[model samples]
Target: MNYKRLLLCLLTGYTFAASPASAFQALQPLHEYDKVSKELVETLEGIHYNRPNIDDAISSKAFDYYIDALDPSKSFFLQSDIDSLTQYQNSFDDALRNGDVQVAYTIYNVYLERLEKRLLDLQEHLPEMVKGFDYTLDETLNTDPDKQTWATTDAELDDYWRKRLKNRALTLKINGESEEKILTMLERRYKNQLRQVDQTNATDVYQTFANAITSALDPHTSYFAPRASETFNINMSLSLEGIGAVLQMDDDYTKVVRLIPGGPAATQSDLSPNDRIIAVGQEGAPMVDVVGMRLDDVVDMIRGESDTTVVLEITSSKGDTQTSKRISIVRKKVKLEDQSAKKEVVDIERDGKTYKVGVITLPTFYSDFAAIQAGDKDYKSSTRDTKTLIDELRKENITALILDLRNNGGGSLQEANALTGLFIPAGPTVQIRDQSGRVTPLGDTDATITYSGPMAVLINRMSASASEIVAGAMQDYGRALILGDQSFGKGTVQVLQDLDKGQLKITQAKFYRVSGESTQHKGVMPDIAFPSLIDKETIGESALDNPLIWDKIHETRYPVYWNIPAYLPVLEPRHAARMAKDPNFVAINAQISDFKQQVETYKTVSLNEKTRIEQQETNKANELLRENTRRKALGLDTLTSVDDIEPIDEDTFAKEASEILLDFIATNQLAQQQAEKKTAQN
Candidate 1:
């Protein structure tokens, strides 16, 4: 069988057959789970990458992951509890295989007890701390506790929790909420959190343990519970019925992060970033206050069958206060039109001539699978839409093209292959290596070149998966000059497997560039790396725990643009010169410096109101100075304060990439002229 089809069978065929007695009879002391545990443990040992020996060392790691999944930041479980639980570290694998999960349940039960006690402590102690604490004092609390030690004493934990509560209060007070409202918010939040924790079921424990086991293999490998699996599929197919806005927990409030490109929320335009969803309800149902609800719970309430309406009570901050708005949105299928390839032309003056540089911003590498399956002749996809945009841009007499993949997280592996086919005279685009070390060259064997003009690709740290594939292929073939920051390094391939109880997303393959270079930890480097807001140390595959290490294999033979090395010499220096003088880049450098300082010098902020306000005003002043620097460079009106500067509607990076495209044309044009001159002289 061919590689892809082989993977399809092997990956999706993973299922656990159960006996009549396989069901759990009790909450703890798992003697009854012998059959289920044996099956799961055996499946993982045999099928997972490396066929990991689940001995004491790996068992210890699994235990660590399981415990950490429940409590990262060392927020719960005191040192004594941790010391008591350390005995089970080397016993999990044996227990998992032998069907003795009493230890797992014991740990979980203890955690639950700790959680209950903590909540009760908070309920009693929060108001006392908020009322008694001297807010005018110069005290500080370290917010991030990634490497913090576990609380040695209950009194020590109480001190930590007191600061946490005080910080929460201070944040709201600064946001113009009265002490009464803040107290109410905190009470509701603590109560809801307690309620949610108390409601954890057996299914939740199993799923949590399953994920701990799987994620120990790799960060991407995960076990999705039935409801979660359904959600994942719905998202992947992009056929879910909901008012499509991505939401996140901002303190106690469910905040609208962003509307999906062509969803009902985006079309409505009433919802926005930083807007808090205070309440939600269905048509004819009483409005439920969702102010302190869990993000997932809020999402479950928001998503419904098609044509159904969800009313959201939103509040956006105005200066130091909040203003409310009621927005009703009808759920519908997400429209892919907005995410499709969009074309723009930028004119840049260089060397006494203006070059019309074409820009195509690809939001995602998507394919309308449903339409394709239904045998529609004109199914929507990245390659198809890109081809159309290129044709249109050619009609505009563009000199070069910039494929903007700045925020493209990538989708559809086939689309990446097809999109690369549009630029090159067809060769291997990517190499896939399966579990058996079998190498498969997934390429565009067809010899079709859609666009042969000078080209550049714009990518950032967010450009990942299929985006990396396309960019890697182009870079390998010398088809395009890759610009911007290094792309996200996610080269491992995974397939979703259906289990009896849940779904297991397991890494099955690794993707290699046509040049035999792997993009696992080391992503595709740019011809000209741009200053980025995303830090390499914080993001990318390398940052993830247990990521696949990069390695090279024998590269597939292919022709490439050999003149790229010679062409780059002139362009690099010219671009660097421009950037040194460019206002936008100067502003970016300053911001990057400020961001670096914030990350490095993370000293605790003073609780004193005057110092806090003064610091905030200073931050605003710096922000305004940076904005005005860019405005002065662009010859726009210089704003006096941060409030005067309007929201940036333009893609500043894309515009700069377009300018770089002009440089590409200029450099190539000069090279061609010199070639002709040398030939003429001969």
Candidate 2:
């Protein structure tokens, strides 16, 4: 089956009655193999949307996913290897159902052979390949080979590797590192790659195949190997007792992908993304090289009891050389205090009058289920903490409010209900549609209004799921205005089920707002949006290949608070006029445009020095232009170069948002007063 036919069938519905919810490799144990596959099929077929059947179409999808997993860059597994696997594309469903992934395992073995050949080729050629930098030498590498055809011949594959290594060296060289140093680093990187490739276990291959199958069902649906399952649990419970940063395998190196806000790494501002972990050590012990080590193994090395310090040897992606440095951080549990909602008051002055805007930033819609189960009343949760914060802010006599739900990727649905309750007084917050075509409304039974005042919910592209529920609720009820970029647009909910001693996270339901809008692919649109740098088309749920489409259902009945929506028409022009002349907003807009253009340009890069130099110069100039423009607007000195602009601490995004709230308060109150006067006279 070709790709087009497979996708056609994926979208076509095929129902099965039983709802229930596989391993091919050494990274996962084939625990209760019979039960896991059976359960997965039942759960997906019975509970999931569209009830996609595991026929030739799904099997073909699994084939594509598994192949993509092994060779994401399309660098390995030549056309011949892909052609050979064509026969097995229609058999994955049958093979996985019977607890036999031997065919998948055999294919993985073929990939292993290919990897060995590539490594040998690298070892043989790299020494002679790193001779000189030729500005005139012409070559082009398709970095994103996902859409590119696979190499039909061995020679084509060889050229791919050759250019790949050349590009690596060329980038380092262009960044101003010495030739000797660049070669040395490349050698080490290759050797580490070889070592890590050797360490790839059968369980890992099984995970790849299993996930391929589940992901074909839905984007959020996934299969986790046992160790990966443990990691998932640690992440789900925000009591991050390990290193504050989430670690992922970037080639052979354990790369710092993101900093958990308020965690040790984020709190200190000592680490940045792309900082590769090379080695780890305790206060008294010798450092252990973690390069080429398994991600879980490296994480284990870094984790320790609270108050214990761990030293990390990092290779910074910034600067000329691959700058290696040691940084130490004391291990501590990522406290609920960190993710907890906090209150602040930003006093904005307009026309000699001040408006105190109460701000409550919710990190995530969290609930301590364990603590609640244990009967602890003092348990920390997003909604409870927010309620307490709102009460405190109310006592402070704030005039307006901003619920900053930026980067809140969501948590407990129960917490979402409660948080939405804080803003909305009555009726259902959102609706959930299960696989059986049954629509259930999740209402906030608690009719307590936390604060009945001028309100705005501040969000960005990172805000999602539970966060969207609260924002959508307030918007639907006309209680508050939504600000910032469109949200992450994740409407589906998942349930984790134990399978083969591992776990399967499957999407069972989707979320719809009270206003009948599904917050699936099309997230909540802001009433007054700010200039955002995020490329929404490429970054959010809309960007995913097989995302659930945006749609509307029957609107649920909900009580309006203060008719904020009616006032938006009068306020939006004021907001837009302010944004038009504002330097920060202008800078952000320019940056957004520049980023998109760069992405477009990055795709067609030439392997020549002049092109590279010119590209680098253009990027630098554009960044500095924005920096200088914003600085000049702020009456600060303009930066001379890119390096000078790096440490400039000026993110006035939220400050500007607060200003917008102040404007809303001033305008809305005046309107309210005018209405009262007219009513009294009448």
Candidate 3:
């Protein structure tokens, strides 16, 4: 079955249940919301993969999630406010069962009140605060909410706000904004926050509260309001005319899920996954602070006409430290051709022999279902495109192949199964476990093995969903050596279901490898590991809230073509020695190590101007040193500063993998020759 088509159909049409509850004055749930809430709870309890018992335990957890969703940084509501609502901690399940969402509305109203009052206070006092700012004082601001405590009193919150506002102004000043401009921006930002708070309706509150409860079940499960469902459909259809990125609300920040391959952010900018979008600015406008902005509004601010420039201030966090960078990108459509699989031949010269290794870089597992439905003979698909590339590589007399699946955030499920068929003759690729505890094996029935020669499948932390399936299958059958970092542990499948109000994207199934291992929390490990730049603490499925745990079922019966593990002892040491000496490899590892050290050291940022400037300069110098070190090793011209460096596609990973493949070939050939000699001697 074509899952994409099914999902698109499911998401396209959604009906509104009732008018949302009014906000600002006295927030209360609409009378019709009771029935809508009842339907949502029933759907989730009946069809969700976990089928979790939404008891007091779940209700309590949901209450915490709801609180986090509203005031993630513990900035808005005070301890007294939470204390007053503590009675509802385990009462949410009962509220849902009775189709009464008064508690949800009440909590939201309380949050709205705190938010509006805070924004109003900021607006009134921002100018004076900026005027009285003293940057010379040595102080630090702990931005990590996890380390922060809830404000016990209103005065404590007031003090926190003072530092926060001071830090904001200081950051703007460092960015070369004039004092006047900083004041103006902060005033406008607070005004906007107040306006947004006033505009929040009952539907918005319901959606957030419902999502809080659903997220307690799993991260993938979510409720989309009517308008949000429409937005989601547009995104899935890939018709949005702007920077191609999947963004979701993470606390108060808009976080990047993944960048669409070939889009401006993916190709022209350095917008990595898990980076938080702090602010957005268009062509010549002043940057708009979007810290507490709604997800849809943030998306609207970033999106615009093709060729227009959108500037994004991105903050990437590791541990408790974050590095912020502003990137300007020219918006454009993410075309299918750009995301299509492409092949290259990497010629590795070793022992006077030039071994040509074919490398197929698959950005995503995509398919043009529309074209296929229209009876078009040639349709775009990962397997079809890859098979064509393999034939071309064969014509070039390539000795081996590498399926580069790095940062491929997965697309079509059928494509993954079909792509796996190109390697093995015929076998199950992955297993699906549904809510009813039924385990079904899905595989390629095709008997033809397209490229059975020595191969390696490259994966990384961003290689998720369908990517994991292909990599896991390759590892299971011993058909290809899996390389690079562990695959992203997102094995669950979600389907959009229409609700009485909005839509519910619920987790319906979980994916298991051919070897019966569930690729849920613990992703597929590479046969040979490489130093990864992607941070696992923030970017993988395991990093998400309440992710499904990894488990095992009965392993599928499949023939192992080769014993790749048996050759690992010899291969690993040789690979490691090369990586340690290789210039590019050394640079990559050094950069990763340097980042880890920075994360450890910069748990809190200095608010003092002189200290902060010194820190920035020190960081720049260290980065420049590392760049020069790699350049000098490669016999290239050394850059004077990190800013002077141009983007270079120095794929040391693939080059090293080619060397490993050559070793495997040589070792296997030697083993076969020795076996023949031993047979003759006997």
Q: How do the candidates rank by TM-score, highest first? A: 3, 1, 2
TM accuracy, model 2 = 0.83
How do the residues 1-682 of candidate 3 rate in per-residue lDDT, one tens digit apiece? 3323432443211111122333357577876778777887798889899888788988998999999888888988999999998889998888887899889988887887777666765665566668867798776777766788888976567667767777777778877889999888788777666666766777777777888788789988988888645322223322267888888766667888888877888877777777888889999987888877766778888888988999998876532244467899898888889899999999999889788999999999999999999999998888999999999999999999999999898889999999999999888999999999999999999999999899999999999999999999999999999999988999999999987767888999999999999989898999999988788987898888899889999999999999999999989999999989987788778878888888767767777888877877887888788889888988999887766875445467889899999999999999999999999999
Give the winner by TM-score: 2 or 3: 3
In the predicted model 1, the residue pairs found to clash are none
Task: By lDDT, rank the candidates, best first.
Answer: 3, 1, 2
Q: State the lDDT of candidate 1 residue by residue for 365-481, as single tens digits.
A: 899999999999999999999999999999999988889887677789999999999998868999998877899999896697878988889988768889999999989898888
Number of colliding residue pairs in model 3: 0
Off by more than 4 A, model 3 = 1-23, 228-239, 317-323, 647-650
Cα lDDT computed for each candidate against the true fold: 0.73, 0.72, 0.83
Global CA lDDT computed for model 1: 0.73
Q: Candidate 3: minimum summed lDDT over ten consecutive residues — where?
A: 10-19
* Model 2: residues with Cα > 4 Å off, grouped in runs: 1-35, 132-136, 145-147, 175-180, 227-243, 247-258, 264-294, 297-333, 368-377, 562-565, 610-614, 644-651, 666-682
For model 1, how many clashes? 0
